[model samples]
Target: MELSELTIHKAHELLKQKKISSLELTMALLERIDACDEKIGAYISIAGEKAIDQAKIADEAIAKGNISPLTGIPVSIKDLICTKGIRTTCASKMLENFVPFYDAFVIKKLKKENAVILGKVNMDEFAMGSSTENSSIKITHNPWDLSRIPGGSSGGSAASVAADLCLASLGSDTGGSIRQPASHCGVVGIKPTYGRVSRFGLIAFASSLDQIGPLTKDVTDSAIMMNAVSGYDRNDSTSVSVDVPDYTSFCKKGLNGLRVGIPKEFHSYKGLDPEVDLAVKNAVKTLEDLGALSVEISLPHTEYTVAAYYVIAPAEASSNLARYDGVKYGFRDMDKKTLIEMYKGTRSQGFGDEVKRRIILGTYVLSAGYYDAYYRKASQVRALITEDFKKAFKKCDVILSPVAPTPAFTIGEKADDPLTMYLSDIFTLSANLAGIPGMSLPCGFSKSGLPIGLQIMGMHFNEEKIFKTAFNFEQATEFHNKKPMR
Candidate 1:
C-alpha cells in the first residue's frame, strides 16, 4: 500500500473494523522504509521491533473497542523529539547515544492514542541550518528531486511522508523548518500556535518560537494528526491554557464566508521565482472560485522578522545548549586531560559547525556589552511582528502567503553560505515570532516541475478556522495530488 495515499481518518475506520491491524500497518511502513529509505535517507534510525510491539498493543485495544482516530496509524518522529528507549539524536553527535527515560508530551499523547512509531527521522544538528546538510550523521536528500534539498531541519520527516515511508511525521518549526520542508516534499504540514502544542520533549531550538506539529499528506490528515497531539500540558511552562477543540469536527465546513488576507509585501520579495509567484496568484483565484474572499493587506513590519529572529532565536539557543557540557549529559570525550579540555572536546566533537556557530552568535549577543543592544532590542522587534499578525487577524479569518521565495533549491546551493541559507527562511520567520498557527500545503508546481507551497496563517488559537479554509481549498484543487517522481 502507498501509505501517503491513506488518510488518517480512513486508517482509523479500517482499524476499528478489524479490516487491518495496527501491527500490519506498522509492518507496511517498515517494509516501505526498507524499500525506499535508502534512496531518500529519511530515517536516521528505524525502530523495527519496538514499533511492532506498540502496534500489537494497539491492535489489542482496537479489538476491545478502545479506539481513536490515530489508533492504528504508523507515524515517524523527528529525531529532535525524545522517544524514551529509542536513540533520540537531534541529528547531532552530542545526543547521538543519549536516550531519554521519559517521553515528550507529544509522544505521550501519541502513545495514548495508540499510534505506531515508525522511527526517528533525521534533521539538522541542534536544529540549525535550513538544509539537512548540517546533520552530523548524513544528509537527507529531497524526495522531490534527489539532487536538490528537502528543506530542514525537518527534512527527514518531510521526505519520509513524501516518499510514503510513513503515514505522517512530527516536526518542529522554529522558523521555516516544518513549512519549508513540507513545501519541498509536496505534503501538508502545520506549525500550530506556540503553546497550543506542548514542547516538553522537543530538543530546544528557540524556546519561544519552537512548536511541534504534524506533517501529513493532506489537509484532512493534517487536522486528524493535529487533534491527536494538540492541547495544554503542565510539563511545558510555555504551553497555553486554552481550551482544545474538536479540530476534525470542522474540517469539512467549506470556505463559504472565509476572509483571507493576502499581504502585498510577499509579491515583491527579491529573487522570488516568477513561477512560484504565478502559482500563488492562481491559488487566490481558486479560493475566490470556491466562494472565499481575498483582500490585499500589509504586514508593514515584515522586513524586521528575519533580522529580529536571528538575534532572538540565537540568544535562546545559546542558553539552551549550555546543558551539553561534558559534566552534565550527552557527548563526553573520556580521554580529556583537564576540565576545560573535557568541556571543549565534548562540545567541539559533538556539535556540528552550524550548531557551534549559532551557539557562539547567541552567546555573543547575550554577553555583557551586547545583551541590551542585540538580544533585548530583537525581543522588542518580535513584539511588533506579533502585533502585526494580531492586527491583521482583526481584518481577515486567515492570512495567505508564499511558504518560501522559490521552490526546492539544489542540495548544495545554499549550504556553503550561512547567510544565504538563512535568507530562504524569510517568509516563515514571522509566524514563529508571532507565536501563531501556520500551515503549508501544495499550491502548484514550478516551471522546472518542483513543488511550491501556499502558507495559511491564522490568529492565536484559531486552528479550526485555518483548517476549515485549507480544507475548502484542498477540495477545490488538484495540486496536492501531484506526486514527486520518487
Candidate 2:
C-alpha cells in the first residue's frame, strides 16, 4: 500500500520498527493532499512548515525510545477545533481569520503524544447544515463521486480520511455530522456519550448536544483515537468525571450473547431507501450468525426525534452564537457608525443562510409568548426520548439502525428544501438527544456505487460495548476495505 494510504496502526508499526521515518510518512500525506485536495476541497488550511517541524521532533523522540500509539502519526483537525496559533475558522466569515492562543483539550492530548498536525478541514458554517453545502469556505465533494456531497458538517473530516488526505481526523458531532459523512464516504466514525470527550475548545453549535469524536479508515483506528481523546476535563463544565476504558481492548470481543436491539420504528421509516434497509438488516443477520441474539424493541418517542432536536439544538445555538455581535474580536464593519448597525451588519454579512434560519427559528421558539408552546414542550419531549432509550436498553446491549435514510444525493438535490434537508438526519438525531454512544461503519454499497452505513448505538458511556459490536461485524465483512476510486 502507498504510505499515504496506511492506516494508523500500520504506520505506527513501520515507525516503531525503524523501517520508516516520521518525515517520510508526513511528506507522503502532504503530497497526497497537495495533489488531490483541490478537487476534494476537504481542507480549509494546510499546516505545511509547522507539520514538517513537528514530524522532525517526533522522529527525535522515537529515537530516544519515547513512543505512544499516536506518536509520529499525522492527523487532521476540523476547522472548528481551536489550535493555538492556527486560524480556527468554523467555516464562517465571522471568525474567518480568528486564531486561538491555546489548544483545545483534545488537541493538547494529541500534541503531548507528538502526533504531527496536518491541518484544518472544512465543515458547515458554524456546523449548521447537513450536506456541507452551507460551508462559507468551500463545498467539500465526496471523494467517491465528485458530483455528490460528502455528508456534513464534518464532510471534510470524513472525506479527508476516505481520500487518504489524512491518516485520521477529529470532528464535532452535534446531530449526525460525523457519522452521516462517514457513512457516505465509507469510513468509520464514532461519537462518544455526551461529556465523554471534552468540548473545551470546540466551537459550540448546541452546547448540550455537541461532542467531539474521530473519523478513521477503520474501526481499530477509531478505538485508538478514542483512547487518546476520551477523558474528563476540568476546563469544560459539561465534561463528565468518569473513568475511560482502554477502547482498543474491546475490538476483539466477539458478539457471543450480545443482545442487539432492533427498533420497530426504524424499519418502518417512511423515507428509508430500500438499499439502506436491506444492508442494515443483512448486517444484523451476520451478527446473529456470529452468536448475537436479536430482539425487537420500541423507542416510542423515536418519531419525534427530528422535531424535538430541531427545537432544542437551535435554542442552544442561538444562545451560544450570541457572542459574535461585532463588539468582540471577530470581523466587524468599520464603516458602520452605530454599534447596533455594526452588530447587524457583521452578523448579516458573516453567517450563511442556514445559520440565520436556525437563529431566527430559535429566537422565535424562545420568545416569551411562545416559550411554553415551543421550547418547553420540546424539553419535555427530550426527557421522554431519554426515557425511551433507557427502557429499551434494559432488554438489549446495543441498538442497530441505518445511518441515513438514503445514499448521498447530488450536491444541490436538497439544497433548496430546508425541511427535506432536516430529514436527512432522522435516524441519527435520537442518539445525540439521548446522550448515548453511537457509531457508523461501512456495511454495504448502493447500486449507484455510493456507500451505505450501519449505525450501532449503546447506552450512556458504554462505548466499549458499541466498539465490541462494530469490531466483530467489521472483521466479518470486507465492506470497510473498499475505498473510493478517485
Candidate 3:
C-alpha cells in the first residue's frame, strides 16, 4: 500500500502483525516526500535521519516484545510546538534560527510513546491568518487545488495528512487554527478543551486560547493520538489536573440517544455560503439517521465572541511575545548602537508585517490608558460567551455547526483583507473562548469539488463523548472516504 493511503490504525496493526516493518513505512513515506513535497511545500524541514533512526529503534523495541500502539507510527509535528534541539521556528522569521532546549509536553509524550517525528510542518506566522499564505517562510498550496489554500496556522499539517505525506500530524488551535485547516484539507482535526493539553513549550499566540490537538486521516487515528498526548503537565501552569480518559475504549460506542444541538444563532452568521449550509444540514440529518437526536439550541452571546477574541488574543500575545526583545531572545539586529535601538531594530526587521501589526496593536490595546476601553471590554465579553456556552450545554451533549463559513477559497481570496480572513474563524472561536473541545471532519463536499466539514463542539473535558459521536457518524456515513482531487 502507498504510505499516504494508510491510516494510522492500519499502520499500527500492520506493524504489530509484522506485515510491514516500521523502517519500511518510514522509508516509503520519505520517498513519497522526495517525489512530491517540492511542488506541495507541505514541510519546512524533513527529519529523515532522525525519523529513520527512530523507526529502527522502534523495530528493535517491537522485536524485543516491548510495544505500544504509537510505537513506530510516524507523525508530523507542527512548527509551533517546541522540539528539543530542533529548529522550532513557529513558521516566523523572528525565530527562524531559534532552537528550544526543551520538548513541549506533547513532544515529550510522543517520544515517550516511541512515535517517529517526521519533521515540523509550516504554519501562519504567529498563527494570525486563515490561509497558509501568511507563513513567513513560504506559501503552502492545497494539494486538492493548487490555486487554493489548504487553510491555516495548521495548514501545513492538514495538507500533509490530506495529501498522505504522513499518517497524522499535531496541530495547535487558537480560535480555529486546527479545525479550520482540517475542514479545508478534508481530514479530521480536533481542538481539545483549553488547558486539556499542556501549553508548556508551545509558542504562545493567544496564551489562554492556544491548544494542542491531533490532525489525522480518520477519527480513530485522532482518538489514538489524543490518548497518547492528552494529560496534565506540571510544567504547564495552565494544565488541568483532570484525568484524561482512555479515548480508544469509547470511540467505537454507537451514538444512539445522543443529544446533539444545532446552534440557531451560529448557523445564521453572515458570510456562510449556501452550499456549506446544505452540507452541514445534511450532516445533521446523517446523525439523526445514525440514531442521534438533534434539536435547535442558542448561544446567545455569539455576536460578542469575535469582538472579544481579537482583543484578548492580542493582549495576551503582546505580553507573551515581550520576551523576544534582542538582548535575551528572538532575532537580534546587532547593528544598532543602543540596547533599546537594538530591540526595536531586530523586532522590526525580523517579524513579518502581520506579526508586527499584531504586536503593535496588542501593545496599544494593553497600554496603560487604553486597557479598560479595549482589553477590559473584550475580557468582559469573553465572560459572556462562556456563560452562553454553559447555558447551551445544559440542553445538549454537543453543538453542531459549520467548521468554516465557506469551503476552501482560492489562495488569494482572503489574503488581502485581514478582517475578512479573521471572520473565517467566527464559527469555531467560541469553543476555544469557553474552553471546550471542538472538531472538524468531512461531512460532505461542495459541487465545485471542494470539501465541506461539520464543526462539533463538546462540553468541557468531554473529549471521549466527542470522539464517540464523531466515530459513530464516521462509521455511518460515506463522507469520510471521499478524497480530494489530488
**What are the per-residue Cα lDDT tens digits for candidate 1 across 324-442?**
89786688999999999998999898888898888999999999999999988999988888888888888899999899888888888887799878877888999999888999999
How big is the positional error of residue 336 in model 3, measured in Å on the Cα after superposition? 0.7
Candidate 2 lDDT over 1-486, as tens digits, reads 899899999999999998999999999999999999999999999998889999999999999999899999999999999999999999999989999999999999999999999999999999988888999888899999999999998999999999999999999899999999999999999999999999999999999999999999999999999999999999999999999999999999578899999999999999999999999999999999989999999999888899999999999999998999887568887789998998899989988899999999999999999999999999999999999999999999999999999999899999999899998799899999989989999999999999999999999999988999999999999998888885
Query: Which candidate wins on lDDT?
Result: 2
Best first by lDDT, ranked:
2, 1, 3
TM-scores for every predicted model: 0.98, 0.99, 0.98
Candidate 1 segments exceeding 4 Å error: 1-4
Candidate ranking under TM-score, highest first, comes to: 2, 3, 1
lDDT of 3 by residue, 1-486 (tens): 575678988988889888888899999888888888887788988889999999999999888877788999988988989998778888888898888899998999998878999899999998877887888888888877888899988999999998888999999999899999999989999999888899888998988899999999999999899998898999988999998888888778578889999989977887889999999998889889888999889888887878888888888888888888877666899789998898889888888877777888899999999999999888888888888888888888989999999888898776778888877789988988888999999898888788888898998999877888899888888877877655
Q: Model 1, residue 221: what's the lDDT?
A: 89
Task: Identify the candidate with maximal TM-score.
Answer: 2
The residue pairs in collision within model 1 are none
